[model samples]
Target: MTSNAENELLERYGWPIEEMDFGREDDPDVIGCAVLEEVEGGTSGIFVVRPGLDEENRTGFAEWAVQRVGRYFEHGPEPDGWQKRSDGGWQLWVRRVEMPPI
Candidate 1:
C-alpha cells in the first residue's frame, strides 16, 4: 500500500504510526503501533501491525487484530498483552509487568 493509504488508515483509526527496529534483517516495511488508553484503572497496551506481510495477509491480520483488541478491552481483563503469531496472525498473551500500588 502507498504511504498515503497507510496514513489515511492511521488517521481513521487514531493510531500512531511509528518506525521501529523489528529485529528482522531483510524487512523493509516499518512497524506500526496502535496504543489504547488504559481502561478500568489498568495499564495501556500496544497493538502492533506488521506492514511487511503479504497484501492478502495484511488485510486478514488487520481484521483479526481489530476483533482481538476489541475483545480485550470490552470483556477480557485489564492490561492484556498480545503478539503476532508465526503463522501470520495475532495471539493474545498475559502481560507480565510489575504494577504500581493501586
Candidate 2:
C-alpha cells in the first residue's frame, strides 16, 4: 500500500499512478520533482521517484539516480540516502540537471 506522503508526492510531481511500474525490472520508469531557483547560479534539486522493482532492491535505483544526477551539481546528498520503496516505488535525486541548457 502507498502511504499518504507517497500519494501526495505523486500529485506534486505530476506522476500518474497508472504509469508507475513496481517490481518489473524489465520496464523501469522515472518520476522527477524539481524546484527552479530565482537567483542566478542558484542550486535547484529534484527528487526523483521510480517504480518497477522489489522493495529490497529499490535502494539500488536511488543510488543510480544520485550518481547520474549529481553530476550537474557541485555537491549533493550521499548516494546511500533514500527512502524505502513503498508499494513498488523508489526515489532518485536530480539537482540543477536540466536539458537544452537553458
The lDDT leader among the candidates is 1
lDDT of 2 at 60: 38
Candidate 2 at 76: error in angstroms? 13
Any runs in candidate 2 off by more than 4 Å, and if so which?
1-41, 51-53, 74-102
Name the regions of candidate 1 deviating beyond 4 angstroms.
1-13, 16-20, 24-45, 78-102
Q: Which ten residues in a row have the lowest lDDT in candidate 1?
A: 88-97
Clashes by residue pair, model 2: 21-52, 22-52, 23-52, 23-53, 24-52, 48-92
Which TM-score value belongs to model 1? 0.40
Per-residue C-alpha lDDT of model 1 across residues 39-96, encoded as one tens digit per residue: 4655344445554555554454455445656676576533445444464333452222
Clashes of each: 0, 6
Best by TM-score: 1
Per-residue CA lDDT of model 2 for 2-100, tens digit only, reads 544445534544332332323335433333332322235553334434444354334433443344444434343334343333432234432222368
